[model samples]
Target: MPAESRTAFSFNNSINPSTFILIGIPGLEEIHIWISIPLCSMYILTLVGNCTILFIITTEQSFHKPMYLFLSMLSIIDLIASTSTMPKILCLFWFNSREINFDACLVQMFFIHSFSIMESTVLLAMAFDRYIAICNPLRYTSILTNPRIAKIGMIAIIRGSVLMTPCPFLIKRLSYCGTNVISHTYCEHMAIVKIACTDTTINRAYGLFVALVVIGLDVLFITLSYFMIVRTVLSLSSKEARVKAFGTCGSHICVILISYVPALFSFFTHRFGQNVAPQVHIILANIYLFIPPMVNPIVYGVKTKEICHRVLRIFYQKH
Candidate 1:
């Protein structure tokens, strides 16, 4: 909160320059080091786990199918999303270095939200993949070919990039007017927008719109996909067939829950949780970003037999 902590440039029309101070957690600065311990461990685990998944998917010819390709995409997004925020978070916690430039903050915000959208899109794609493989196995090979998967991946990237492109520009138009301390660890969208002294109605509306479009529509479609999948699965004559169908979806379901549950909690709390503690919001925000990346690979690695075998085979060979 000190003048020395902020590096603001003079603007001509009396607008406050864009600079922010990120207090890791508002009332818990004393335990930042303690907080960093588990966060750092999660980040390390995220890196190692996602990287291993990527390595296995890339190196193994057996993993060239649509499912594994989509898994690889998820791993990549998790890596980028967690990396975008975690290092700065660690810096804030470990070294008490919390000054982030406006442009830098915008870039961070862009990546965080963009990758979040990307992850959701990827999950939706995976749901579609599951729906196809379960409901229409005969067309599975013909439908999700490598080229079609590549297009889906490309569309996911472009959709996220295009939708989130306006966010930073919209934030740039707001007048900070010297109120620029963000309570959260990272440059979250609403967190940054809330500090602006000018009217943030447009920003708020657009933010909500984006959330509804990306998260809302995607969740709906994913649910619909699963609904059809379950219907088709139930209609299968043999119990073993039904069991196998459900078994294949277990890991994706787990990943989807971890990805969305914390995210929705943080999203709603940020806007609606007036009685909620600030620390709780901040902690859950970080958890939503960190937990998915850390858990996705573990979920898949354990649930997917091929990955488990290949991982064990590598360790066995190394040993």
Candidate 2:
């Protein structure tokens, strides 16, 4: 019999309420301490940066506009998403605590994936906000009223929660007769599902479905929004007006690329890339979670004059 068959035959019975061992990075165990340095720094920066953004938005009444409201939502999502995984990861690296309760793992997985979906939707909403601001400045305020923005925020929360609600329950139904070692830092949906001894077609299919539908559709709409925005910008007669329109969009475009590129790469590698090393896969997964939350505030701080001015004002007052 094949090695795969032999391994399957060894653990035919299901084990309920298993404990999963998370190996920080499979091949890089020796450098786990060294690796913690940058990850820790990034996590700190993510907290400080996102908190600053939220503080600025909340205190400044001028920031009550749609654009800033969407940014505040994004900041909140980034805070929770990064916090959901980083603390446990740090513990794994520094204290060598690798064991996570199966139920806890499921909770982590749900929060991570759900918040990710919410972030994507918020990005899509931000794209729509840009589209209206540039394409129909006259109606921008009327179209994206406070109530409408509130509805968009509520929908993002509901859509993400509803879509990811099935993942943990689906995972619970499976039997983990095999070794319960998860090769990654956190309880990623597929990572947990892969250890199941039972048939996992439902979990796999549903995971793929959510990825394709949520990410696929959001990307499609964001692309179309930018396409229209570009067309409108070019139609403007003055060079300064065109420059201003594109300038407004430049930060958002950078943010979109930062958020999506690693995410797409990680998703494809998980589904394909059988030849890829485990360490690479695990590192990419960490990056997909870490980089966006860390980089978003920095990108916006540099590009947004209001945020920069507020920061400077805060510093000046302190001095």
Cα lDDT of model 1 by residue, 1-319, tens digit: 4542334333323355646888889989999999999999999999999999999999989899999999999999999999889999999999888888889999999999999999999999999999999999999999999999999999999999999999989998888775567889999999988878889999999999999998899999999999999999999999999999999999999999999999999989988998999999988998888999999999999999999999999999999
lDDT of 2 by residue, 75-147 (tens): 9999999999999999999998887887899999999999999999999999999999999999998999999
Q: Considering only N, C-alpha and C atoms within 3 Å, which residue pairs clash in candidate 2?
A: none
Winning model by lDDT: 2
For model 2, what is the C-alpha lDDT against the true structure? 0.92
TM-score of every candidate relative to the true structure: 0.96, 0.95
Clashes of 1: 0
For model 2, the stretches where C-alpha displacement exceeds 4 angstroms are: 1-14
